[model samples]
Target: MKVKIYPIVRTAAVAVLLSGVSACSKMYDVKPQNVVEAKNTYQNIYDADAAVTGVYGKFLGLAGQYEVLNELRADLMDVTPNAGADLQQINTHNVLPGNAYADPTPFYSVILNCNDVMKNLTIMHNTQKLTDADYNQRWSDIGALRCWLYFQLGLQYGNIPYVTESFSDVNTVKDQSKYPRIALADLVKTLIAFMEALPYKDPYPAANSLITTIDTYPSKMFYVNKNCLLGDLYLWNNDYHKAAIAYKNVMETSTPNGPGDSYNYYNTYTLNSGSDNDAVTQSAWLTFFSRSMQDREYQTEWIWSMVFDKAFAPENPFINLFANSGGKYLVKPSQTAIDNWSAQRQTDGTPYDYRGINTTYKMVNGQPVIMKFLYNYVNASTGIPSDPLAKNGRWYIYRTPTLHLRFAEAANRDGQTKIAWALVNAGIKGAYDDTTIPDPTQRRITNLPFPYDFDARKLDAPTIRGKYHRNLGVRARVNVTNLDVSLQQNANFLAMEDNIINEDALELAYEGNRWQDLMRVALRRNDPSFLADKVYNKLLKDGNPAAATVRAKLMDPKNWFLPFN
Candidate 1:
């Protein structure tokens, strides 16, 4: 029982002991064990700091399952022939209690870690070693993380036990009866309150210095920033206008040079000022996902990303399951994803969208495979790990483009079509028109143009909708005029909403948000037909009746939330 808590305690002890160890000494030589040592682990501010870091470690550990459960059920992925029964169950939307990916224990473990930190936070601060600013930052960090975990729990397994305290007795831990599951809506309200109390920025020390020397790659936005969770909560709550505001606040306050760094986005990634095939565009795209931020010194566009170390943390399983060198390679890109990127063309029709060339997927033995998370760790030509043991790369939770799209979605829902069009266009144009590119011709990716200035009287709404939806390949099988007519009526909003849904698929595929993206529209519009029309129609397009049955089961609102393990 205590062993479950030992990792957190030992990690803290290591952080404290390392302060006195010789610069050449390894910190892992001494490790703490047992309840007494765990009780005494955080006797100082440094120890408390380490415990807070442990919270992040726990969060990172959940990324693999988190992504799998979120993505596999969505349409972007297809279970490979090599995928095991567990993976198959996920792809079919038939998750069972024993499925490792569906287990809630890892997420609960993170909650417990946060509880442990909150319990001891005061003692560390009262000792005078911790400043008020640092204390507030840690408070926000712990609260936002808890809110995020709870939000995931609400989305995945609705009606989760809302535990906020640590239990020292192993025997007492078995008492689930004491902590009954709360409704998802009630839990979301609680999460909103918890997150709103947090400051938007950590605003202490230098910007890039928010992270420790040991974790040089993480953005402070990953921990201290709160708006990502706030925006997520608002979006889920159907507060579209508020969600737009929340996301806008984050974008405005965000530093382009990563969360705490001094540099802005343009400086951080340095838009490639070269030809479409130039090394600059290639490097910029690669560096955005790679560790060391392409040596830019900070994360510019990444809102929050997980950190990994070769010796301690688990490597990203997305890489492990997708990289050819990763052996298992259990998941494959759907034809939907392949077509989404490949179908794009420049105004002149020259296969103009190179964003897909090496950024998202690439041909391997004449089979198109996902390339986003694979490129940083594996060699493109050989399909082998650049380093057999390489364990680090950003696992994105939020980034600039997704936020842009979300804002666009919310704007469209609010009846601000011009705003929606402008946002969608800007997000795409921004990606292609990066001034950092030395050659303007090299920077272009899509033929789509920005929305004409907002004039309802002058707007060609149907054509604009068609262009945006067509560019992203999101329209349902229905005709454009039909979609446009549906767009005009509040009752037929799902047809219109498909535009954002498809855009999300096109722009944010395989990033672990697709299921929620599907659920969001489904839940908001109270339209289970979306589940049948978009998901099953495209995902089960191969004519599998069994898959069709699973889609029917999934359409039931109860199945929208995951089962408890």
Candidate 2:
């Protein structure tokens, strides 16, 4: 068996795992564990690859927080009676520094590992221990992962300690003079610079198993897509045009065929419901979130995924958090969220969104547990194995739908409201017909740019129709009616942006991005009421008496972030 290469990270990093981590200047300074000597580390390619895997192991530890911090604090999720006081505080937007989820140690631990991995990988390349190709791919993967972690930290805490170098002494990081705290905006700038400069912005080549297969799972889902992440960083940085370019890059993937090519990884869950394959259509949507990374069709829809297996690591925490039966059921979909899903129209001309009931979350034992994570876990017909399996499954940190939604957000802000609206309701083709835009001048303005115009059916007679027409709108994929864009001639981007945010809730809710979506939009408009009203309305639905106070607190931008102690 190959050696399990633990990262030779800083003493402070390992200490955080032992004794908790705090967000204050004073950090955990205990003697480091798992300290491997330099001579024993990164001796070859496999060794360096193992070190990156170790970083992912640390990332997996933070997977549960991706849901808790992002979802629990927002309107789509609510704490149940069984939830701890800490969870309650987060839901109410009154997070205490002492709240367990508020601690920054896990994030820093992963960041420190990423720092050490990059430092060692550089050393390996310099010493001729690795090929230039191997060096670039590994180095860029670790760099992107670090950038993603920092981005998440910045979003959650507002201002965070931006440390990029790897060190041994805990005091080195504690010395705020050298490594000062930077706001989310500055961090985004640094991250964009670092990622944009990486030589290999793509995933590891086929020969490199690090980017391909990890046991039964694809490591591509494990590593963050550099462009997808850059797109998100640009979004948070509020550079809409650049953000649109970044997301567009992910869709095209620098390929010859463009976004229409089936080879694209940013493909969404296509809904092709028909009499001949109604169940098959539902199953296609079902496997979109599973341990079935082996499924090529579903794999296209996943940009980044976290693997959890009962046989490999401990059982995933999601079952305990989201499953109603054989689970703690700490939190569930909020009543308002349920109502939103109920509000959508399914393709079968049904009243409710097919994704909402029995798909996203299901009624089991009289409780509505979040089913996205624990999908197919119950022995219901949806079970993947067709038998009871452990609750362990994959958690999507980023996926296809998320990329499209974010792209629409940036595009709308960049003055492509019709194109953005199309991405949400009718898709690139459906939203751009002569009737959709009507006037030739308006059509020209609403026309999708190169990659986004996958279908490319224009007024030109030759290029307007073909088999290359696969870009289904988010709502259209679910059998919902196309949005009425006829009345939107005078609509500003902000109003369209609000509609996009609503689409975000309908399309990508409970995937650990709901809160950030609400916060980002609110911050962009400088309208506290945009965000406050949503959470306040959620509280009123749940009958939480703190609704008024929570809404009042969120009216200030300061309360949008969690406390650091």
Best by TM-score: 2
Candidate 1 lDDT, 442-462, residue by residue in tens: 332343222222211112432
TM-score of every candidate relative to the true structure: 0.77, 0.86
Query: Would you give me the overall lDDT of model 2?
Result: 0.70
Given candidate 1, what's the lDDT at residue 512? 80
For all the candidates, what are their Cα RMSDs to the real structure?
8.6, 5.9
Q: Mark the 10 consecutive residues where model 1 has the least summed lDDT.
A: 473-482
Superposed model 1: Cα runs more than 4 Å off = 1-39, 126-129, 168-176, 199-210, 215-224, 254-283, 427-496, 542-545
Q: For candidate 1, what's the RMSD? A: 8.6
Per-residue lDDT tens digits of candidate 2, residues 385-439? 2333565577678767788889888987776777777778766657655555555
- Candidate 1, residue 532: how far the Cα is off, in Å: 3.7
